[model samples]
Target chain A: MKVKVRVVPDGRHLEVEAGVKALDLLKLAGMNSESGVVLVNGRPVTEDYRIREGDEVTVVRVLSGG
Target chain B: MAKCSICGGPAVAYIRYQRRYLCDRHFVEYVESKIRRAISRYKMIRQGYRVLVPVSGGKDSATVLTALSKLSREFGFEVVALHIDLGIGDYSVKSKEASIKAANKLGVPLIVVSVKEITGYTIPELARKARRPVCSVCGLVKRYIINLVAVELGADAVALGHNADDLAVYSMKSFITQDLSNISKLGPKTESIKGLAVGRIRPLYEVYEKESYLYALLTETPFLHEECPNVDFSSMENRLKVHINSLEEEKPGVKITMLRNMAKRIRDYPKPQLPISRCRHCGLLSSGDECSFCRLTKRITGQPLGPRAREVVRSLVASLQLAPRQDSAYKS
Candidate 1:
């Protein structure tokens, strides 16, 4: 039960337990410093979104400046 | 598992209002097509016109630039960019570099303008000297500099990165303050004012914050992840943002609904015409005796703009006036 996660642009990827949340995966990959929208399989999900086996996740920043 | 409404692929994002899940590729197409529709629906872009997009090396602006660049190929319009260096040490340097990288990636020409060089005072210096908040001063400087740059470049329109969240916050604040006069100003494209040579466009007006960020990431657009050192997250906007996020969590697509209503109200508002007067100091059109920027600079500098400064500003205004009146189509 391993899930594949990749952070775009950074091209960083990792495998984590299927039960892990998106935030947990990001933290494990050392890419959790900034705030971003986590996408699982092709849809945006909350950080608490559970990662199913074979799920592909991407973390993208969502903040805007004036 | 949810399926993409269009492709029947693995859906990555769920659009509550549309009541459908979108796969990564379909989501990208959805966002880009939405941008295209918003632009044409609002007449944000015109044929044979140059648009000035201010890039701050942030995800939102970068996404706007990338989208516009992609559209420019088929639309037959030019997209140029302006990046302001406020001289805030590493923040400014890194932000400028990111803007340069994004502009280069998009293959668009970018002009980097320095506040200290043009105004004789860096943002930090002016913030320390002015009684107003640092964010206010920074906003003033950025608007003034970008507007001047747009005019100098003969741009027909100035595009900002404000998205659905930003407009929603603006509406919330305006509602609380009971200031309805500004409501008409919130929309996809603003009418060209008498004084300014160019109108303004919010191409990302309907796009959500998360969607824009994801667009930037998936497109590999270079942008800064750092916030301004002087920014106050406790400000009214930030507070409203938190509140809005909570509400959005409870009911997705609330922001979009609010923005839609706001836009409709604006469209129904009666147009108000006012006489415009030139600011004596800068020779720019002003509703007051002196423009807000001039007054702010004077208050901070503690003196009239010297002859040289006056001449510089006057020349800039003169050049702006000489630019072609390309935004006449949108004029109210």
Candidate 2:
């Protein structure tokens, strides 16, 4: 069930297990902040993105700015 | 070490097909390569003066710091690192850390200033109150704080990490505004008013942002790289830069040279008309009854900010700037 996962933040690459929620991938990527959004190919996705094989996930550290 | 072409000193870097040599202690030749000019080309440093550099822990500032540090030794000026912590979540924290690391690498004294300490409010609080854009508020606050602190430190000039990209934006805006005097004030060097104390300079004015980024990667500073979520990169300013940058391949130095020339022309021409008076409220330099910053600060402070806020909405509607929703005009 290992799927190719390129986590953002530290950009640590991982072979996370399949069906892993996006939030888990975020934590696995070594990111710990109040809020960091994620995107798959330029579209914002919630923490529940189902892990498929070969996903280019981009984690964005959202600054609570005006 | 490559021997100096003239003095037979050791040289490690090459420039413009010139086999230059500079000794370890007498390093003017090496400094010139980093600064892209001979020592005489720029008024980089004066006798026994100290410079405060506003570093963002980004590649641009890192390159500026390195270049200035090397050049300062030859030019005989003291260099100090200045960082403004915007409290932009992790970005600010990482930036401050990188700045500290850069300061350590360069062996210069560093001063840290934060909104929380100076202004009694963090960036989030300010942004929340005004509903103004984050970048605008943060940028103005940072610049104001740096200048004020630099002056307080008795620094001759405040150096910034602004690169060619930022300069190009200013040039374009100046051209659009047709404000010649404003352009004149924005050369490679800008001095504050006589009583203002600290001037502003961009020693890395000729350096490109991409080059800075690459240098950071090569230098291996522990930096957290992330763009501010607030700025919509698709905005007009960014889009124009990208478009003009794309055309740079067709004609080399098209955008830069043009901007450089425009800057020179403005420098050579008449000064822009100064705004009437300083704002009554905060008393920073201002062009109107209430500066744009003060107005924004009021809203950010959770005040009604009534009449001016309405004017903002009317102006937005009139200029077709931001959207003009009826009830939303006074929400701020």
Candidate 3:
């Protein structure tokens, strides 16, 4: 979807075409659903959500803090 | 005017007892001397660096700030105050307020970060899903957040509010788990990733809990006296403190002294290493592909990505499995 993927780590980014769901696209780009956090333009997106062109995304390793 | 306790030098007044007129300045000098001795003995802080003191606005942290501030002035180093609010309602409020008060009182800059604002989940909600050992998660978060913030804000070291009793229980926990490597990381001084962000240091490593509390009381530093709600008194340290409190009627000072010594001994004879595997996904250090914490959180939030926290919400999944249990005799 021509998205800028920032893993808090830039090396984890991958550019792909639209039509792929955001979750699947992230998974394909080595984002582990178990420990990964997905934030599209600073807001979190659920798994079922899809990706569109030009989305600025940040994916983090889910740190469950008390 | 009071006579000196030890060297019998010029003294202002008797400090707590006879032959102990250490004087106000002398008392500070004495504490500072002990702190300096420990720093030199342990090689705690390096030259030309900023130390980040994690002040929770609690008595421990406020007293730590006051002492360290004095150290900074005398020892000619710098210090920064850091506060993290786990979003625990009024308790967290008290902590934050207390921290601000300390910062104002000490005239040090304080940084406050909230879990809800930074992460999207309050500590309690996250705790419900993340569950026990979330304390460690909180600790890790504190580390990561502080390091990240410190690096961004240009700090070099990080000090925590951990007391002697906390240290004792921590050492005991390590012994129980037989995790020598984790024990190794529990040193008075440990450097963080150089390229990653800031180096971390703990000035209060030698300071006792009771001493900290006493300092807070004597200094009148505004600090929260209550414990975090997440910490049940079931902790070994708490239990031990309670038992000791009943028997000896002494303040928390003894616990602090014993634990500090234990950690010092352990640090002196360092020989422990635990394997660290990075989380392939985030590149952060972890013991598994998905850390247990991450797995449980995902599972609780319907992700079921982890093993056990992934147990399905069967009540909704299979209506028949849930409908009949409320009243055994009135099963549908």
Candidate 4:
């Protein structure tokens, strides 16, 4: 029950447990749902979206500027 | 996968505020509609007008340029893009390239101005020489350059890319700091004063930052995704943005509602009409005998570089080869 998670701009990669909500996945990667969006297989999904086994998850940071 | 609210198609996004899911095509339409509504609500553009869009190679600015370019023909206006190369190392280089790509894709004429060439100092250099923070120096330089270029080009309005989240956070910060006058300037549009400042319009006024990013990505608009190297993540504004977005997570559409309410009551907090005059050095708007740009340059360079900067921008504008107006592009 492991999924691949990749964060954009920072280019970080992590392996997290499947069935975790997208929001929780972001938290595990040291990001907040408020500042970024979660995409499953290149399509944006809500924070409540649950990851599946072997799913490719990407987190794109939206909050920018100083 | 979620289904599009309007059609039984695979959805790309779920707009919590609207309680609807939208496929890729529908999402683009929704964003464009919001842009059109903001323009109509503010009466931002008019027929036979030229708009100067200053692009910074960021998602917000890219989204603004793309939307405006599509609507320009329909709205009976021309769009010209301006990209100021602040010379922040590779960041500036990438920014200029993205600006060029976006402008080329839209077939909009673009003017490029190099701060280093005009002032003999990059933004960071100027900040060090002037003993001011980099962000402060950059802001002053951009404001002066934008206004100068817009005035010289005879642009009727300058389209900015400040999205809903940015404006809301700015308004809240201004309120907390008791900067009521600044809050007065935070609406969808600001009118131009003859011989002084050109009108400013925010086409992305109703669009959120996240939505802007998504639109830019889905539309394949070229933009630099990297944050400026000078960003201070610990700053109050960044903290405020996080807090504001957290509130939005709980209550969808709060940002838009708050901004709309603020716009409704904006005139109640009118900024005092300060006595404005032309800067003797550059012949642009100034509050005192000299504009802040001129004063800052004079302090750092031993002479006011405002006049030189204006001349540089003028020549850049003059050299632009604008495309022929294509009225047919707007035909429905």
Candidate 5:
């Protein structure tokens, strides 16, 4: 099972394993899970949210500033 | 999908600290309520007071301005937005546009001050001429300009957008670096010195960085989602923020508790009493004969730009046509 993941502002895209937690998906996409909020099909979800097959995930980076 | 704790509607966010899921509306209300609590706890604004909010077109500042604008009517205070164009090429262009858009949406009068227009040098140019880091230069200029504008407009306080995560990371960094003075100034509000500095208040002091972003998104507030190009991702501050958030993931509410405890400790800590004096050049708050802004400009341009900067700010304020000592009046 594969899901599409897109990182905001940078517009980076990746394909990752489904059924994994949102936090793990962020890790798989080379981002710190703590640094972003995961959205599944435009709705905000918790880090424990499990991605489904073909789900559209958007990771909005929240950690800002130097 | 998780149900909202209050309405059992489709939840937009799960607040780990409180162990509650919330819909978009409730999440926004929750964020705004936290801001109100912060303001009331600190007595940050008084009735009939005017607040000057400096916006950077970023999520935190945008959220701060939006929340305060909505709160102004309830609090009996007036809110004004200020944007300083740092002239950092395209990034600055986008930032200024977003700031203008946010202010326009709120019908808040915005004062636009350009660094290149006033100082005859962009931040990068000044950094190069002064042989200093860009971020350091940017911080000094922003601090100087914000205070100057606040005083010129006769605002009762300047509201900043520093959130809980920022305070937590800074607190940890300060402790690790043994910068006790910085820690001492990390509370929700800093008092004003008569005829010198304006009081600074943080309305988002208790809100998390992610919550701020989400509030702006849900409220349809305009903000630049991109980080400044000058931001160093590998900087110690950024790393510390990431590390702190990771701790938060393991133990919910640690950031808020840490910040609260730090504020308590700060209240008990003996504050360093530094002799405050007016800058001879600009007549603003200064630790010595010359302020850091004046010193930096003098070093870079062979002349202090503080007086000129003040003149620019004064003219801009005068152009606003605000009634003398009147509250809630501004020119678009």
Candidate 6:
């Protein structure tokens, strides 16, 4: 069971095992869930959300400003 | 598996408004082109203009910085950066560090200004002396410094990184307050007044908040993610954002639609242009005799007015012009 994960802006692509948590994917890409939003299939989900095979994942930074 | 609507590659995002699936490459293309279109549509940047981008050590600003850096190379516009240090303990430390890293990464020159150094008051210090809430004062200070820096740096315009969600939230708050004046000012580009002010632009005006975060990460742009240690969750804007987020969860593109309505309203009823005047004291643009920055600084620092300051205060009082009255929640 493999999933395709593409981390944006940096444009890195990864193939990971199924059951990989969104948080773990972000961490593996040198990002943290605390600062980034993880999306599974275009919908926002918690970091603990698990990936299924062929799932397309994107980890984006959360928005804030002065 | 849903395929990209553009390229038919594996899709990474489903744009609710367009009902389109986008793969990694196509999605990146879509976002960048959208930004380019926004800049042209709004006439935000012209060839060889010097634009000052303020970095908040967050994804929003970093995305703007990175995007503009990429664009400037080919377009011949100069992009410089300024990072304001609010001096909020570790928050400032982390924010300044991230801002520096991002600017350095982009090879953009950055100037760091501290509230304490510039105004003799840090944000917390100003908050303590402020009659209004901290966030309001914070907003005032940021805008002031942005204007002040733009003047000092000789920038033709200031570029902000506010994304769609931020704009939508601002629109919602203005709507709730029935602040038509504020609503009129909302847009992608604010044309620079001939005598009084540098223009303002939002390069990411059409971008979503989530997409901005992803852009920074994808570009390996460094940014701080920690919530402001001094954030007052009790503020009207914060509460509204929470409610809006819930609405967004239930209905995708709710924020975008709100923004669209805001734009439509602005188009339907353009604001009467106000004459911009220079502040006698600071020589910056002012609506009245004193700029909002000068008035705010005087109030927070408790600086007694000289003949000049007194004249400004008198003008403000006579005109009944005050910083837009904060809602009851902002009463200190």
Clashes of each: 5, 9, 3, 0, 0, 7
Q: Report lDDT (Cα) of residue B232, candidate 5.
A: 89
- Candidate 3: tens digits of C-alpha lDDT, residues B54-154: 88767667766887787787666667777888888888888898898988898876767666654456767676656646576676556656654554444
Point out the higher-scoring one by DockQ: 2 or 4: 4
lDDT of predicted model 3? 0.57
Candidate 5 vs candidate 6: which has greater lDDT? 5
Model 3: per-residue Cα lDDT over A1-66, one tens digit each: 266666643345666666566557656755433334455655444444566776776665421111
RMSD of each: 5.4, 14.8, 25.5, 3.9, 3.0, 10.1
lDDT of 1 by residue, B2-77 (tens): 6778888866666766777787788778889989988887788877778889999888899899999999877888
In candidate 5, stretches whose alpha carbon ends up further than 4 angstroms from where it belongs are A9-11, A18-20, A30-33, A41-43, A48-55, B326-332
Task: Write down the TM-score for model 2.
Answer: 0.64
**Candidate 6 per-residue lDDT over residues B127-244, each given as its tens digit:** 7876677777788778866766665455678999888878877877877887757767778877766545677888888888777766676677899867787666567766666566
Query: For model 4, what is the alpha-carbon lDDT of residue B40?
Result: 90
TM-scores for all candidates?
A: 0.80, 0.64, 0.61, 0.94, 0.94, 0.74
| TM-score of chain A in every predicted structure | 0.71, 0.58, 0.69, 0.87, 0.81, 0.80
For residue B174, give model 2's deviation from the true position in Å.
3.2
For candidate 6, write residues A1-66 as lDDT tens digits.
877777654467888899987768876876553335677765555455678876668765453533
Off by over 4 Å in 2: A1-66, B1-42, B177-181, B268-270, B275-332
In model 1, state the lDDT of residue B278.
62
Give Cα distance to truth, residue B220, candidate 1, Å: 0.7
* True interface contacts reproduced, per candidate: 0.24, 0.00, 0.00, 0.56, 0.58, 0.12
**Model 4, span B35-97: residue lDDT tens:** 999999878888877899999999999999999999998998989899999999999999999
Tens digit per residue, CA lDDT, model 2, B61-143: 77778777877887777787877788888878888998899888888777776666544577877777667677777877776
Residue-level lDDT for B99 in candidate 5: 96
